[model samples]
Target chain A: MAADQLAPERDTRAVEAGLDALDGGGELLPPRPGPWQVFVRSVLPPVVFMAALVGVWQLAYVAELKPSYALPGPADVWQTFWGTVQDGRAVEAVWVSVSRGGIGFAMSLVIGTLLGLAMWGSRWLRAAVGPIVSGLQSLPSVAWVPAAIIWFQLTDAAIYTVVLLGAVPSIANGLLTGFKQVPPLFDRVGRVLGLSTLGRVRYVLLPAALPGYVGGLRQGWAFAWRSLMAAELITYSPSLGLGLGQLLSIGRDLSSMSLVITSIALILLVGVAIELLLFAPLERRVLRTRGLTTDR
Target chain B: MTQVREQAPTRNTVAPPPAPAAVRVDGVTQVFERGRPPVLEGVDLTVAAGEFVCLLGASGCGKSTLLNLVAGLATPTAGRVEVSAERPALMFQEPALLPWLTARGNVELALKARGVARGARRTEAERLLELVNLGSHGAKRVHELSGGMRQRVALARALAQDSSVLLMDEPFAALDAITRDVLHEELTRVWTEQQLSVVFVTHNVREAVRLGQRVVLMSSRPGRIVREWQVDIPHPRAIESPAVGALASEITAELHREISRHGR
Candidate 1:
């Protein structure tokens, strides 16, 4: 026991020395990249891919692989794309489709969140709709277009119906999975704090499940975009305005490949732009603050 | 902080006022899993208001289970735990502070749960932090602080609950030797200043001897309270003092004998 007494005193002195020797531990944080480095990292890879795509097109053209109308050069596609943009036709078409997608997406967001939370309330509810919601996610958004036409018939309501059907399941499933993944430790802490059921959900469960819920929102947007395109192509009237989907359909009807390519490019650009400008930054901030995933 | 368990009947009464115990656990038995033997069997203990009692035990001695039963986090299979306080604030060996919240925010949560007014929560939380010597570290994230600093923040959060009793389950066990020593002093100071009754749990004999006014030892596997000592040493006792060392050795020998019985 005397020996044990001396040992802890000596251990205490060693621990004190160790404490004095320790640094501030700032080295654990990753260094911030400079502006020039960030710009290069973001811009260079995409530029290289675009260049490679153009090179492949040019090579096919010079070799006379199929007629000029069959595989038009990148320059021809750009010309038609530039023409549409300069005349404000592309911009108008974008506004029409994006507004439709945006409205549908907002509705789905509310509906999906409510449905997901309802699923969390009981195992029976989860067992009933859980598999069905997941199954809906795998079904193509375009597959709903015919039924939507029969139900709403060439109206803006029909397009919205298809868009909602496409996006709602993804958002709902994301929230369901997110809630399921909340750590049991948080439940113990919640009970200790004497939080009410609503308080526990608000303060603990919701924020803890945010990463997965946001991931679902991102997927929902993709589905909404695709559904909007499918509905627009199939059910267009002059009253509905010429959306990008209609423009692509018109190009096919008129046998102009350049117009078709231009529409495809605009659709791809919108999807990429939304992901880059909105969801990526939101996900990064959430993951970083929670210490879930580091920026590096 | 003394609670009058009952008021006079508004007339002259001859009965003496009962000195209410902070906590009373009578024949507490805990059976965690069905069809398995109970983890704790027929354990009884009482902690008086403002008294510091250390529960010393071997590894599987169900000491934490006893603390949980007192904290109202778990129920005893047979027997009752009576506490005069509204609810006992519990501190774990790990800091257990929410990582998403700032240090002050963590304390504010306890105050919020206790139904303190929104306008008063911030000031109350800040005062608690100041009591724990973490006034300036309120805005810092959990990971930003050192282990000892985090534990101090946790202590502040526990105090924000405004409970008359505090239950600590090896609260300083994970800290370094020097840090643990500093925390023991800090805890003793805070405990006295606030007049909080505490049931501190630990396996270290020296820690039990140093901090407790009374020490209770338990045996393992369906843990039972085997022995107890009322330590009469005065406050501000040092761990390295000869008196603490002597009592710790005596208790250590008893603990060894208790453990040796399991080998057979």
Candidate 2:
């Protein structure tokens, strides 16, 4: 009779304790929101802000706030953009700019990585070249355009030279800072484990410095693209196919406002697409793995 | 109160019975000039094969400096320090497990560095983890494990080196009391089973008494060995038992005396 009476009470207390454990000791389930909650939380505000900006732009255009040449309407820019695409020159111009940017960026990545490694590995090399690298980074790539033209005689080589000058320093500086930030704890750990110099570089230092290196590459690509455009605009050669910069120059010379707007729009679009599609995602993933990003 | 065991005569001890001295430091002096006085002076100690020794001292006593010398991460300015076989494995105060690697991968890295055979590496790493009682945590990332679990993985990594001598610099100092007590028990069990020589450095007096067969007390600022106590208390020492408490008090008092002398 006593056992039967106690059993139910004991079970009830056990259930209560389990509930307490769930609530107080461990991570509990978060309260769920309605089906449209996330959409409301994430999507609504951004859409409203964009709509507001567009409304303001349309109002300004309707008010005749500025000359059409100086500030084209969104409709005019869109029409110019669509017309270029329909005629197929926009596609060609994009291909020309991207190929140049891609090739230049790839070359910069290799050269910069090697130079950075050299600077990091040797004290004498770092002492000799480190200051020069910093000085080069500070000096604008446009400053190299005159020297590059003189050296390479207004060809693709000139554009390539300017791009290299622009991008290499950013990449090298990124890696140098990254190498410096690697904690001493890792080096000690490597030494204790008897990692060879090569093994330490491969297994520890490189992996630790990857995020910084990737950041450098991203910066270098932007610099390379900018330098290429500037060089192409300043040193127009018929032999070199018309890139976006060349197309913009042609539009300006001919006073075709629509063409000018179209080329400018294409440049901006390509830059945004590269950042959004590639480097941003890459950086986010790296940061998330390192716990540098919040879970949410 | 249980009677504390007195030290056996040094002469009758017969030089710890001629077993291989896994780690031998003879008149090791480390001097650091940080624009100041020397840091360590004439510190001599040894760990016999399979013996567990603790170097106990206050902060700034160069205990960590001494451990660094043993680990070969830093060279001593003066005197001979030798590990009979290979480079001794080291454990830092923090878990120091690479954040990028999982628990098992951390151990595998040590094995790889030691040039363990590819075919044998996985099984050997698993065995080490099992010895540390973390057999099921092989797949867990370093950050996912609790502090105690991380230390256990570190212990497994140290074991992966296959070094007869293990030098630990207060590996449990950061842990909470309960976690520390559990680890102490775990360490004792692992050390017994592996029969590896250990040189553990710490400031905790009871911990020194609990885990060490011999506890060497070091004095500060150009640290030197001032006292050596050989604990003969039986396995699984009860921290609150009269014997453990009495010895701990004696060591604590001796440490206080050494610290006081530094004012002179």
Candidate 3:
């Protein structure tokens, strides 16, 4: 139809300015808490919870509910914990276990990502190996400790074997889940944009799958830590050296309740510290970039 | 308005089409699978260069299927679908912006796909964003944008492909009425400015009237073009204008007749 060309009722730039103002949130991003505020919010709650736990332990001791050998006083456990720290045994044990976990998890990450890509690329491989991978995740890594000890002779190899078994399945399955979550629309968008097959995977498919993949990595780390603890506790040869789990095992043999309690606490601390320092931040960043985080 | 199958229904039907054809679909029968009725059977539609055509239909009419054909996202089982230039840009019912990218980043990806050098992409992306009246909001992530803004960005992204034709599948169908109305004006302005051929698919009668130069009605159950109407009303046409309403009701009556057939 012969109509005069678009005559803007108002100046378009002015209109755009108004529209842009309204398009953004009235408050935009909520102000993040300052470092002090963050400390209070996060650190305070856990500190209070731990204090209450210690208070309960003190009450149990005051009541003399169990023999002193069976249930050590909270103060006695604390003193053992500090003694382990001062003697440098704590640092050495932490270093040995953490290094093993880190190396084992890295190998699993590479192998698991390749396996996932292969599974994605070929439907036959997916059909053949998909169910087994998922089943492996439910199978506790500790179950393999005896087998690994027999195969690798109760050394670092055995500990690493257990860690890899525990983590690889979760990492592989995480990649698959991420791939599945990518919408078919993305491929079509890729096609319409004239992206090649590799380009499609690199740009659209990979980014879409990232949130799920990070979730898998988080779960994998948890499994690796648990499995490493199980392996060290069970298959401690002289060659395997001292680790937090070996301390826990030694404490059990010696019948020192405070040492056993201290070892368990250190193990728990390592697990939590890794999560807080590494995986939590990584997962948060991935989800935040995709706007998948619910906290706006 | 005429229903002649022999020739394209242009404003001056007596004269041969003035512009070169942008798209030509000849007797395309798209049967997705064997042993099933075809979704689009013998559907022939032509879009001339720089023309704005709206395809009106009921659900299951293969409207989207046909657009997919023109987009080269699909192949016709029995006939030919041709586009004169490079692959046409396509817009979805949803904005389909990648959530991980900023609005400008999405457009830049399209530019990169077109083989625009890495050096020129940033400025080119900004220019396209400005075209859609979103120059200031290029850095905003997809989720940060509102529904209307997302679609506008989508339009900009489509333009980044630099395609001569644009195939839109109900691009405004998901918007609220007020937002939809505003988008009609924006689309009209963009269409006239770009002088690009658009194959717009929609079921909204007034939307077809307010935007398209020729509104082509289609039938379901093996989709076919049933009728065509040439809107004489001039551009900058208001959605609520009386002329748009008058023609819209006429098309609505025909659409109602088509829908009532499904009841049986």
Candidate 4:
């Protein structure tokens, strides 16, 4: 009886030791970075970089590198930025641009996903259209504005057309690249599990291709925003309201360099804000959850 | 090594009788490329229900290819491979668990594929996780688990397939010794409890002998079954036990002889 009892204890110990060894060596559970640590690492450096950039801009202004009328100092631009905001023009302009960009990006996402799946499904289609899609990515968003204006008559439809043309190819290519990169082992495993082709695409292929898909989404957003701005600047209608691009156009027409600089600053700020707020965090989470991110 | 002539080929020509087969591979040939030689040629084997069979051979023996054939991932160029169940669940050398999924989610996927309802999947997945001694770590991601734990989760996922046959391709080869030993014990207990017919592929002689009721040895180039040894050791066999050691050495000697045939 005692020997049997002792044997069970010994087996438990052996199992415990084995489990401990399993938990050893390549234990990649690095301590999660604290919020304060994240703030220092991610937020501080960019703030410092921006500060240095402003200092350089101020230095160039102080040195009188250009006439004040032609090139505004940081203070003049800052003053104009505040005036624009105080008059509520900045908020309206931001809302107009952001809403338009959001709608255009959503449309691009749907269309691109369909196109990508089609390309991935057939070698013939991929060969025929894959290069064309990639080529569209190299064609600047600004380049689509003239054709969009001709196609849709300088309305919001024209702006959306430009955004779609600029963004869809990028999103499609992202999905294609992601699909291509999915490990063959996953497909084998999926097959063993008896998942259907559609099921495999939904559960295995899409999740596996997320990093590239998200990368495409980020690029697509950038394209949509750029194309919207280009369209707004070139093809203005009273019904479109005061978009950021319209603000920039107005500043140029007024010949107030400070206003132009202020609008540019606001545009830059919005771009950075969207990336930091939406895409960067999304990409980081995707990578982190997959354990693809290392401390280095 | 003892030259026991009668016990050498323990298959049709020597062993008393064959049991009800859970898996049957008859004259199966696998050709990867048309111009090159076949990976496996004229291989014949049968695994009985509730029996643990180990396929042992040197590297490039097409042992993995044979498992893939049985898994239905690869179709043989000639002959037939049959499993008693719908399909056998395969465990690769690597865990091959979806990295994005938690341990429970990975197991749940198999159950889901098996058409388990959403409401019952959680409980079923939990039960499978408990079977592999990973009940507490079910929420952990694949990368969070240790290598051994990952394999255990994989075993649980395989279990979730609810298939009678389980094909493991050197599942514990990547693990440390202590972990491998523990896994061996766990596997034996689970195999007995679940009454599964397992075809475990490994290069380790001791692992084959320790775990298998029958060890099938294969030769390298154009892999073919060369010999078989029937191990009559009782259940709950320890890796370090004398019986296991003796059988392992015998099989190792046979394996080395098979390897030597290729060296020329």
Best by DockQ: 3
TM-score of chain B of 2: 0.92
lDDT of 4 by residue, B1-264 (tens): 111223454322435346789999988888888999888988888888888899999999999999988998888999899999898989999999998898899999999998999999999999998888777778888877788888889999999999999999999999889788888888988899999999999999999988988888888878888888887766666777777777788889988998998778
lDDT of 3 by residue, A91-169 (tens): 9899998998999999989988998889988999999999999999999999998899889887888899999999999
* Pairwise DockQ winner, candidates 1 and 3: 3
Best by lDDT: 3
Model 2: per-residue lDDT, tens digit, B95-178?
888766778888998999999998998999999988876677787766567777788889999989888888999999998776
What TM-score does the first chain of candidate 4 have?
A: 0.90
Per-residue CA lDDT of candidate 2, range A97-204, in tens? 899998988899899989999999899999999999999888779888999989988788999999999999989989988888788888888888889988888888
What class would a CAPRI assessor give candidate 3's docking? acceptable
**Chain A alone, model 2, TM-score?**
0.82
| lDDT of residue A54 for candidate 4 | 96
Candidate 1: docking tier:
incorrect
Instruction: Estimate, for each residue in B154-224, the C-alpha lDDT of model 1 and write its tens digit.
Output: 89988998999999999999987777886787788889999999999999999998898778898888788
Clashes of 3: 0
Ranking by TM-score: 3, 4, 2, 1
Q: Higher-DockQ candidate among 1 and 2? A: 2
Top-scoring candidate (TM-score): 3
Itemize residue pairs with steric clashes in candidate 1: none
Scoring only the A-chain of each prediction against the true A-chain gives TM-scores of: 0.91, 0.82, 0.94, 0.90
Q: Which candidate, 1 or 4, would have the higher lDDT against the true structure?
A: 4
lDDT of 3 by residue, B1-264 (tens): 122353224443434358889999998999988999899888888899999999999999999999999999989999898998688999999999998999999999999999999999999999999898888889988878878889999999999999989999999998877667677877888899998899999999999989998889998877888888887778668787777787899889988998899898
